[model samples]
Target: MRRLLFIIIGLLSLVACKTDKTSVPQDFECFNQPHIYIKYKQPINGYTVKVMWLQNGEVGNALFCLEKQEVQYYYFTEKWTDKILYDKGNTYPNNTVIELDYTTKLKSEEYLSDDSPFFFSDVDFDGKEEFIINRYKSGSRESNAYDVYNVTPYGYFIQKTEAPFTELENGQCKFDSENKTITIYGSNGWNNIINKTYQLKDEKFELIK
Candidate 1:
């Protein structure tokens, strides 16, 4: 009976200790105001986690959490730093290379001085995630901030070979990370709306009717 009880206890301990994946809500300094959301990893066992939410009376800007020293840390700022080496707004203390995706629109040659929110996923479905920069503005935010990127093996961010959307207006996007699909809805005109869906294929966005 003693040996049987010990075996049962060991099985229970394994059940309690197993962690395939974990989801948690983390608060970060967004737009100098506090924001919260259920941010999860794309593949759950993947290399990165992303946080994007609505702020400034709209949806844009994002926070990225990096795992280092057996603890998680986030990179967020009330202001955009002009540090040349600190591209993508993620500046860590030990100069660790946190993988950041750069999209075609927000490439290294382009200069966007304003603070931005971002979206990340394996939009290309190449087993790697990409990023899109979101903008905040006074009167309204335009839909032109849909720059996307894929991460190079060397850790440099390169823009996507093709764009996800040909045009964009004021709107929000829903990313289906599981299926690798992106659906966007935007106000096209006074009363019309633009609804489009794109799937990742051959490293390009294939529009779905």
Candidate 2:
């Protein structure tokens, strides 16, 4: 009876250990301002974690909590010194924290420099610059996927996911106003390079070959 009791207690301890290993953490900083972009890698409870978030007015916000293989220690402000780096491949099991409509006044302490991920450029040739954000990193060539939000005449942001915008992912773009074309060039993955040119007509993109 004594041996059997000890075995049962040991099994219960093992189960508790497993449960703790897979448990997710809950504490994190939340922002309410638009165009908020934060990126940092740090260690928490023996695991390496990467945090990244970007917010836009009306359109929404996105956050990523990635698990990295190696642990890195970073100073709070000094961590913002480097430009954003693209991921080499898919990350481990991770979490995402979303703050959809944080509508608070901008605080001075939460201010980020021009190293933000948001910008504006005219992709549809409408004589107005559209809102653009470097959404995610993809491919082995350090290319990025972009989110293009067209600015309406009434000052509203509408996301465009059709051609030209869809095909522009995982690459770098160059806009030519004279030729009325948008050129995207970058590596697709390990072997292939992407170089596609598209012309805008009637607010749509047509492949120019």
Candidate 3:
């Protein structure tokens, strides 16, 4: 009888441990995490990825990668000013970027998982930070594709799709802020390697020696 009781207790303990992992803890600080990660499972091929990174206590930006669709971008402010809903078909017209609210009751997986490839940095040496998200890495060469955005003073994201920014799509960047230059390392064709340097000039990237 005691052996059966011990087995029952062990099963109960296993159930309890699983319950803990799946639910949000009561003391979770929703807005002030490293990066907000919320996963919403879909009924079909894949799930949606919603990630918002807070630069300060007040403002940040978010990226939405819905399956089979172009990735959408939005910015947020004052923590609760923008509320991002997980459901589809909500409308924002004219293809302009909008503000997404930062309201989420879901427990963030930021602490449970490793840091994602999302962050804010001063990539232009303009003393203002830019947002960078590494969308994916290509095969073998591990070429990294990036979405780099310049944040406006009014909390907007203007995507930089020009020269050096375009160069960053398939290569890794090492920024030298003091020298105001970017060194790129990437491959052109199979078995052909390239190392190039570019200087940040007039808010543009110019290829130099």
Candidate 4:
């Protein structure tokens, strides 16, 4: 009887462990819903500029801001230096400035000059925004790379790409609401590329050749 009771207790423990592993919480729901339209505001040049979030997609405005002082100096000196001052007011009118401390995973204290424009857009229709970030390497021109992020409603970048690449150049992206298509065209290498249309519904890119 003692051995039978011990075996029953062990079986009960195993069953409990299996239940714990497979149980789903009451409030758990899959996060696959489409995003609604949203807007954000920031202080620019003593006034406020309103930036709107993309609807049914990911990707927002390009962020243009003064790099933090220590970071700016590091980029120029190539050595880690703490001697620098950050000027906030010396910025272009149409340029959008965002705080690196707020959005990115990188530590703000390590870098130098940070005054590069980070381009971002909703290239994929996945209701999440992607970033074109600028990084100051040791000896290269300030590098531009692409990143993706799942942002919150309060303008915070949540999940981001682990690695980013610098393949595409800067250009304007326009979406056709009527046909659910996107048109991207600008500079590619030395020549001016034009009229590259992407059909959103079909997920195909057609280059006018």
Candidate 5:
């Protein structure tokens, strides 16, 4: 009887652990993270290959990646910013190359799809296309949340802050150009397929029926 009791307790423990991983409250906010914006995209090889970066604000370091490898790092400060002396010895939009430290290269499985990094849509019906960027590595069962970015009607990027934006944990989202909404579909948990619709309100996404 003691052996049977031990086995039952073990099973119960596993179930509780799994519930912790899979459980998400109905009103939980998904994109509650700090705003990280892709600052630049420049081609290193051909059009198919390029370099890009994302920075938090005027404080955090900028993460630069070539292909799937993080090849450089930069801090967002006047000291470092002033060191960017020239725009390739030219002008703005051309890009100023800066010295950067090399970071570890990503393995083969670390790469996302070719077009996976960017999704463009006008979720607010403002006639301006908003870009949604994600770092979802291909073939991974997890790592399925969003890196939300919505550009302004003028030309500034803004982060979307709202609750229940899709299932948040496992929802794979797509922008519906026709309806001006973001449709996310995935499993809530335990083989339950969940679908959600969201529309932009005051620039952030809000859940809608």
Candidate 6:
């Protein structure tokens, strides 16, 4: 009887241990929290990539490689950001130049200029910076791409760009800092033209007309 009781106690102890183990959550488990998703098309490779940012989570940035059919993870903190490419049970090398190119284009213009790329600067002097991208036609045969960037008190920078302007069309920008919004003025060389605004909130960027 005493041996049987000991066996029962041992089983109960094992059960208790399992219960305690499950009580503590694993750090790597996904919490399904609110996050932001951003998508952009690569100018060089013509690949559609998705960027995800988990708001207030451990995973700072995650990239989905649509062309290569893979996923790349990045850990970002206030000081630095590190990228880890998961491939076949091993980490692959990160294409920082390609990533930076895509990110710069996404942040500013759709078409990236090979000669005069877009720039960033702090135009409003509000400590927060902005982006400036140049737009020009390939057939124009004119050096129309002019971009610049200026530093700001805030961590980010500001941007400015120069393009062709007509009497009916003028260059202007509209900003909404509270919602992190940016707008660009478009011209059709004639009438029926309107200003367009873009909002960058929660990792998603949308064009508002």
Please report the candidate that would top TM-score against the real structure: 3
Candidate 1 global lDDT: 0.41
- Per-candidate TM-scores read 0.37, 0.43, 0.45, 0.27, 0.37, 0.24
Global lDDT of each candidate: 0.41, 0.43, 0.46, 0.31, 0.37, 0.35
Of the candidates shown, which would achieve the greatest lDDT relative to the real structure? 3
lDDT of 3 by residue, 1-209 (tens): 43344345434333333443355457643322333433443311222434333322322333333233443333221222122322342433212233333223133321111122444556677877666554333213534455567866544466776767666643255768778888877767988988789998897778996
Instruction: Write the candidate numbers in order of decreasing lDDT.
Output: 3, 2, 1, 5, 6, 4
lDDT (Cα, 0-100) at 189 in candidate 6: 60
Looking at candidate 5, the ten consecutive residues that score lowest on lDDT are 74-83
lDDT (tens digit, per residue) of candidate 2 on 71-141: 22211110111123212222222223322221221332321113334445566777766655444332234
Worst 10 residues of 3 by lDDT: 107-116
Q: Give the true-structure RMSD of model 5.
A: 19.7
Please list all clashing residue pairs in model 1, or write none if there are none: 61-117, 61-118, 62-117, 62-118, 102-149, 103-148, 103-149, 104-148, 104-159
Q: Write the per-residue lDDT of candidate 1 for residues 1-209, one digit (tens) a residue.
A: 43344345434333322322333225412222323332342323333454322232233233434343354434332212112223434333321233323232244322222333344545455765564444333212433344455555544345543545423222455556567677767656778977678877665677894
Report the C-alpha displacement of residue 107, candidate 2, in angstroms. Answer: 27
Tell me the TM-score of model 6.
0.24
Model 5 Cα lDDT, one tens digit per residue, 59-164:
2222322232433211111101111222224222212343322221133232212224334444446665544443432213734343444554443345555553
lDDT tens readout by residue for model 6, 74-121? 212111111121112332222222233243433343222332223343
Tell me how candidate 6 scores on lDDT. 0.35
With a 3 Å backbone cut-off (N, CA, C), the pairs that clash in candidate 3 are 82-100, 82-101, 82-102, 83-101
Residue ranges of candidate 6 with Cα displaced over 4 Å: 1-170
lDDT of 4 by residue, 1-209 (tens): 43344345434333333343354445532121111211123332222222211112112221122222222100001111111102232222222333222222233331212333233445445544453343222222323223333434444343342211112322244555456555654455567655556554454444332
Off by over 4 Å in 2: 1-115, 169-171, 186-194
* Better candidate by TM-score, 2 or 4: 2
Clash pairs, candidate 5, are: none
